[model samples]
Target: MGVIPFLLTYDIIIKFIEKSSIGINYLLIMSGGIILSLFLKGYLYFQGLNASHEAAFDTLMGMRIKFVEKMRKAPLGEINAKGVGSYKKNLIDDIDSVETLLAHMIPEGIPFVIVPILIYTMIFVTDWRLGLLSLGSIPFGFIPMMFMMKNGTKKMPMYYKSAEDMNNTIIEYINGMEVIKIFGRTTDSYKRYKDSVEGYRDFTLDWFRESWTYMAMYTAVLPCTILLLLPVELNVYLNGTLELSKFIFSLMLSMSAGVPLTRMLDFAPTVIQLTYKIDQLEKTFEGVQLKEGNESIAIKKHTIEFKNVTFAYEEEDVIKDVSFKLRQNTLTAIVGESGSGKSTLAKLLVHFWDIQKGEITLDGKNINKFSVTDLMNEISYVSQDNFLFNTSIMENIKIGNPKATEEEIKEAAKLAQCHDFIVEMEEGYNTIVGDSGDKLSGGQKQRITIARAILKNSPIIIMDEATAFTDPENEDKIQAALSKLIVGKTVLVIAHRLSTIVDADNIIVMDNGELIAQGTHKELLEKNHKYKTLWESHMKSMDWGIQVEEEEYA
Candidate 1:
């Protein structure tokens, strides 16, 4: 509609000058048509824009939901391997980048395309010779655009990779800032952060440099549809092959034709980017997803058995031919040196990653036979990480059992030995934890997580260094709480501190991903040289101290 007035406005001015008898009525009708065309053009464009935005927002919401679901269904090991930073980019940044393409390309680009076709047809119909002259610059203009697209395609993956690396590095730097400050290693850490920033900057500049020359050429040449027509049409008029009015009409149509083509070409890069983002998102879902039964199974008992389980994160096995069983209503402790696969064993039991060879069973049923939700419902896990969300203390605990009552939450917190401190705070249970529970001390966070597990009251509990952050004064209280929680429940404890697990019913010692010893703590200390060595080292580390007061007196 706008295109009609645009082309007519040119024709009307030329016609009025050629025929002065075209009176005030004709001029009034022309003005009214122009006004109507502008009104219709604005109205229709906005209507399409409103529809496009609604569709785009719906699509965005669905896409984000699907991505989150995929992440949940993905194997935990794979998620950890990809790192959190890349997922953040994919889920938030990459998904957001598609909005503009969806919102503008369909509504706006279509009109830009249709209007150009109509304008070009009008030019050709008016005078075929002038129409051909108007399009003479197209092939030349496309040359630079093609080169630009080619360069962009070749360099885009590398550019995204650099960006992903920078995101990962910056996330790590921010997360580890406290540790860096504590160790007085700010310079070295800041050097890594600076390097990532500078590297991203350099990659962006280099990517831009690759296409800038072509971009310049295309921008200068692509919109000049009438550049060739003007000179050639003038020559034709001089030769008496073209009329003045016809030449002017053709020129007007040609100018309008170039504008839409320019707009269309501008959208080309956005199309490429949209495709790339979709491809990247698809790649994120390509890895092994956690397979589970559609039907949820009833867990008859809390017994867990590993039947010659062999597993590996990569090539080398993290757990080789490992076999163990936790009987119902038993407390089992797994003790080992650092990097001895103790953590891996606990994670494997939870089906964090499927074993390379062998089977793990829960209640005499293959673990894989149970739905993910059903399996999660049967076990409570508190890892050393102790990650907490930015929410109220009560809400954080309630996450263990979403339907749990307020009294149940407070009871769990009291059992975990953090209720007193929580009550002492200004907001009590309503106090909002900062990001990852940064507002709380390490001991406080660990206790809160433990309280969550206690609140859940699952039949099986796996605690991977759950007491790591507890100070000496609070260790006994935590142990007392854990004692009550583990009663009548199968429990697996992975601990570095020998004293904490000495009273466990059965002790399993692993070395180099293989279970080397299994016995009572007393039996291991008497018969197992490896466990004895670890126990001795632990005792010395615990007992080591200086006689500072005596030295000062001397």
Candidate 2:
């Protein structure tokens, strides 16, 4: 950026000397030197831009990726309220708009600014009258440009908003395509897509119309400078108001000044657009917040604790003043009906939302203090909605422990009761699960998810609705595997299959987001109406009405 202008200046100086006849060889020699230097500078600039472009792309991409990674470890309620589509739009599409500003407007535009300053300086010494004429004409061209900016400014926000809507529409359309297809609502997506595109198109046309309207007045009709300069030059030539050479030089230099001023005018819209784009990026980047220690790479020892916690969402009190201790090495089952905050309770334990009136600690330290990654590492979570990547069964299992050996992966699969079924498939563990594990049934997906958690080997295990949908046959096998997994671990289970955790060391019962009862299954049944009813329900569901069996809840 700094080199190109000086080369141009040197070339101009050679031409000036040739006009002055400062040794004819001087023109040839200096001109050749300037040409060669310009070629070298051009080559170097192109090469530098190539390398810079590569670096810029990587840096920008990493910035976006890291931004997302940061947000993933934040409060789920906040992230959801903001909408994933909007976040993606900000992270990718909005950021893409800044690329031109950074790569072109910043680096290349520096020289444009400097070259004008050099022109003004040279013209000032050569002829103050022409310099004044040059300077005066530059500002006159801006009258039309100022009006152009005023109109374009009004439409800038509309254009950007239209782009954002397009991004949001694409996300929603893709995500809901199946529903759209099932309901035969295909035109919804097309309409949304078309509307967003049309908005951008209309706004862009308006912007161009404003520019060209002003452009026609400024360029086609000749700027005030030409009308103004013509009189000054003719008066000087006819009346001998100045030296012929000086008058001649002034005319040529005045014309040269037009190109830069015109260029500066051409760049006016870019400057405006780039400014707005940068502001948009800054707004998004600043609005997103992060928890402390979230950037640390080390995992710390911590225990999950809920202390007099009260959590609510908008107007719904999902957890009301509930207090419990999740022991360091005990299996704790939290059994409750739907809307009893079973899954919500699990979310609390993982610090997905901060309790409104209570504190959650890990190893006696606040969960907020630990870096997000560190906190996640302390607990292996199996959400009610179990998800798997579209990859090999082995790869999905290995996600929990990236460096785990094949043997270790197989061991986790066996423990989760997934190994046998996986091996039955032709490709075995190598079989692709398809998108979100669609190739597998719900039960198969659940088992693989369990395998993933088992492989994580976190000190704390949270299994929310862990065994709810498994068939009786697979349920038994999964229960057997889970029995081994929960032993000597701080385990929190949210289960609807009440029989599976009948002997849990502790059972917590929640109703309307409040802890109604908590105790051993036998103790709870003896003391609480809710527990007794739930126990009776479980017994009837098993169809063991008259069968003799060991009564753990007796």
Candidate 3:
């Protein structure tokens, strides 16, 4: 296709120079060749582009799936430490950037690069001197591009860091919008968001500013193959050393090489960006992961034991040498002040993080011996976050048990005390929960998550401040429902409100990460100073409202 146009031009020039009649058949044949080349070029390009896109999409899907699988195997603490924004950028933006490399660079760029090389070869065959001149401009063109690439490489780290930082800040700003508004910190939050955005913009502009000069030089010089070729070729023709036909053919071919060469050069930055994106993805893929075993042993009991378990998010252990036993079908409560490792202990049992030392076992088998799926199937965890998907309330509940019937879902929702309010909503079970259940109140979302857990009906249940958001009236109702739901189940409750877990079969009092006392609530209150003090605090807090009302009336 590229050679045909140049051939046609050269033939016409020769016919004119010869001062002879141009044969109609010769013209027809050349014109037909030109048209056929164009049709084939378009057809092949379309087919190649479609194939590349299909391949790119498949690769993208596979990459994302693998990334998700890696994250699933990774420790929850590691994932949380990186922040949602970082993963979002890696998963969506960074991975998506590869499409340009796979789809455009591989399919279109190869042809562009090959066509230029082929044209240069043809020119070399015609006249070695013209080919040599055509090659002269390439070195000069590449010098600036080399400088541009060097500048891009030097600045790539800063550019990517800023992009990731901006993503993190934007996500934080959006997610914390409610808190910002409630606390009247809108200006501060907005300033941080604006600063991150500006930081990214500044780094991007600085990089482009540094590269643009080199870019202009290359963009101007690369396509001007005639810059050297035309002058030298014209001189040769004028000196009668080169025939007009050969001269015309070489010059036109040199000119035709420009487009493909320029197109090929355009992918240079994309290649660099692709390398950086892959590096970022590899960081996640190589992150620390929770180990799992291939064992599928059936457990006769749901008893969980954490024996001399030590763990940490970083250097210092948050759960230091913690040992406890949770017998099957018993309700155990973990209570402590903030950062006392109450929730951490429960999370350890859930295998959110692997223990640094000792063992966590189910039915006397090491928890690590059980596959993640097998371990998760035996326990239902309702975290403090009460995270719900942006879907129908019914669908969110059904996530606990995908095959759950509608009646079972409704029954679970009723048990969680969410059924009445769900029915009152316009769409009832079909209502979209909105992003992270923003459509529902804090308590409503909590109830929905509890409903999910209830539907799961796993032998083991971990409730980390599950009812923290429920009002006093609803708390009692939810507690009653929970009491029924926990029958013959190993239930572990982490609570701030002492009154809620008063009836727990065993209460584990923690102070600073150590389990200081473990007994029935009454026995712990009687024997442990920490438990007595915690009970005192709870009693005082519970009386504050009544005291305030009496003082107001007086």
The top-ranked prediction according to TM-score is: 3
Per-residue lDDT for 1-554 in model 2, tens only?
33344444545665575675566687576666767777876886687677667767877897788677667765677677767666777787666766665565444565556666776676678767766765665554667778888988898888777766777777778788888899998887679778877877887787787788788766643234444556776686688766555555555545544555555566678878878876866665565453445454443443467888888866677788888888777888987778988888888777777667888877777777776667777889998798989899999999999999999999999998889999999999999999989899998898888999999998899999877668888888888888888777889988887887888889999988889889998899899999888878888887865767877884
- For model 1, the superposed segments whose C-alpha errors exceed 4 Å read 17-20, 242-246, 539-542, 549-554
The TM-scores of all predictions, comma-separated, are 0.93, 0.84, 0.95
Measured on C-alpha atoms, candidate 3 has an lDDT of 0.89
The TM-score measured for candidate 1 stands at: 0.93
All models, RMSD in angstroms: 2.3, 6.6, 2.2
Q: Per-residue lDDT for 1-554 in model 3, tens only?
A: 65677778678778878987888887898788888888887898889899999999999999999999899989998988888889999999999999998998766888888888898899899888988998877888899999899888888988888888899899999888889999999988999999999999988888888888987888888899888888888888899999888888888888888888888888888888889889989988998899889879899998888899888888988877888898999988899999999988988888889888999989999999888899999999999977989999999999999999999999999999999999999999999999989889999999999999999999999999998899988898999998888899898999999988888888998888788899998898778999999999999988786434445553
Ranking 2 against 3 by lDDT, winner = 3
Ordered list by TM-score, greatest first: 3, 1, 2
54-173 per-residue lDDT for model 1 (tens digits): 999899899999899888778787898888789999999899988888899888898888887788788889888887898877888899898888888987888888888888999999
Residue 48's C-alpha lDDT in candidate 1?
Answer: 90
Prediction 3 TM-score vs. true: 0.95
Task: Give each model's whole-structure lDDT.
Answer: 0.89, 0.76, 0.89
